[model samples]
Target: MSDGFECFKHVGLALDPIHVGTGGARLGRVDLSIVRDPVTKIPKIPGSSLAGVHRAYVAMAEKKYPGCAGQGQPDTSGAGGHCCDPKCPVCTVFGFAKGKDSTTGFTGLAAFSDVHIQLFPVATREGPLWVTSPEQLRIAGLSIPEDANADAVYRKSTSSQPLNLGWLLLPVKALSEHSCIRDELNKLGVPKHILDRFGVVPDRLFSHVVNSNLEVRTSVSINPETGAAEEGALFTYEALPRATLLFWEVTCKNPKHFKIGNKDIEAANNKDKVHSLVKKAYPYLEHLGIGGMGTRGMGRLRVLEPNASSNHSSEIEQSDKDKSQEARH
Candidate 1:
């Protein structure tokens, strides 16, 4: 039988480029706003978001090195050559669109360890303003003139801050339980070494549910009483589960202030902090392969480390036998 449903949590993990300062952490705010139980107000980190961040990072890596990434490649059309049916091979197998010509199936944008590594490009006077200011103006259903001096309009609509390159540092508070990722390990029969090294938190669970599908019907008839036969069919589909989390961060820079020097200095400061945190979290990068094959791309799998720390360093250290095996190959 197939495995049952499972939920994962990030509990207590903090990813940084994290600023300890009052101003927004260089990496922004790490807010794990979703709790485990809504009634009890327990919070949990979402696995999907974690996966998404990893995928993004993968994509970023691919961009840095082209011809390095690709995804599952299956001939979508079936033997029958049917067109656009629900069970049609293309629609069912490939989903909506085909992937790019990259060699790797998985993009590196996922958050393997809830360690959020982000970059803030330098923002100029117009840069930060553009974040809030409209690139184009719109009034009612029609667009407003571009030359209409919309700066004032934007100011009236929302406050401004200098847009510049810098990282925001913040902490993410996520709760975990035994069931969250353990179930996956159980199915995969992960080795004891892997289980121990991965920092498996037994029974860490989160709240997530897929709702039932809604039903809708429609019928049409030509003449009121005279003519009358009608036929109908039922349409059914599953509703997937959706998850959400809140985020917040404090910053020293006033939203009202606009200083080039501050923006430049802050941008540089944040960038440095973010890179440092990323280096630290690099050690856990290999755990992303918890369930299946690790990182895959063009004829190669790059097992990497985020960085090192004395605290969890021993936890992720490799065995001599494993190292010798790796070296031999």
Candidate 2:
């Protein structure tokens, strides 16, 4: 097997508040809470959730749903929803387990990473501002000013007035004129309006600020028989607010060296093929949404195109041109 793999970073803009629940109510301010990183205490979407949805959407896109969308549990005849054919894009990109034996399963060619918040929107006196931190910028592969630290808020706006992030008021410090943070943000496809009001807060306060500004809504269950609210049915939940920017990475392994059921996969002979196949499902993620509570207007995320230079940059440009030409028709 070759040790060749390519990793691609993707940025997404939330169109609706996203809520990936923790399965049950927590004894906190809200009855229902979203999953959070244990160390940072910051909310994040698990890679497993992303993988499951991406697999299903890819199957649907390839017109192979119901067969290549499940766990591939065999039936009486030992066949399953997964075709287990090496040539199948769905099965090749996302591995399958069949034959009721561990030896028959194949690990998938692509792996997903957890989605992390890049720019969190917070309500402030200056209007709705996107809040980020030095640590957050570093994680997104952006450079911060040499003098920038986690002690004060930094922004390009010359306003000397203190800013209120949620209920916390913080004094603003003018960002360095040489800082390339804005340019980097632009390359990531952040809206110009959002960048105009961007504010960088101390890393120590980022978690608190984000949690304080999260969208919380109260819900109640109605009695099926009487058209009345059920007793003790009122509850509250939190979600990552709309317009939040998030980042995630996908790693595609070279598929030329892998085989399934003694047959090599011809569809994904190159790593780019595997990456492109997985990206084809991104449109589904944008339209159909991710996370939970989709029917109630939540979890819609729009994946932005990568504008940075990379090995596949030319291919991406060509693809965009083709899309534009198709739209003109």
Alpha-carbon deviation at 117 in model 1, angstroms: 19
RMSD (CA, angstroms), candidate 1: 27.5
Lowest summed-lDDT stretch of 10 residues in model 2?
Answer: 308-317
Runs with alpha carbons beyond 4 Å of true place in candidate 1 = 1-12, 15-36, 64-329
Predicted structure with the largest TM-score when compared to the true one: 2
User: Which regions in candidate 2 have their CA more than 4 angstroms from the true location?
Assistant: 1-3, 76-79, 100-102, 177-179, 308-329
Q: How far is each candidate from the true structure, as Cα RMSD in Å?
A: 27.5, 6.5
- TM-scores for all candidates: the values are 0.19, 0.88
For candidate 1, the per-residue lDDT at 15 reads 20
lDDT of each: 0.23, 0.83
- Which pairs clash (backbone N, Cα, C closer than 3 Å) in model 2? 67-81
Backbone-clash count (model 2): 1
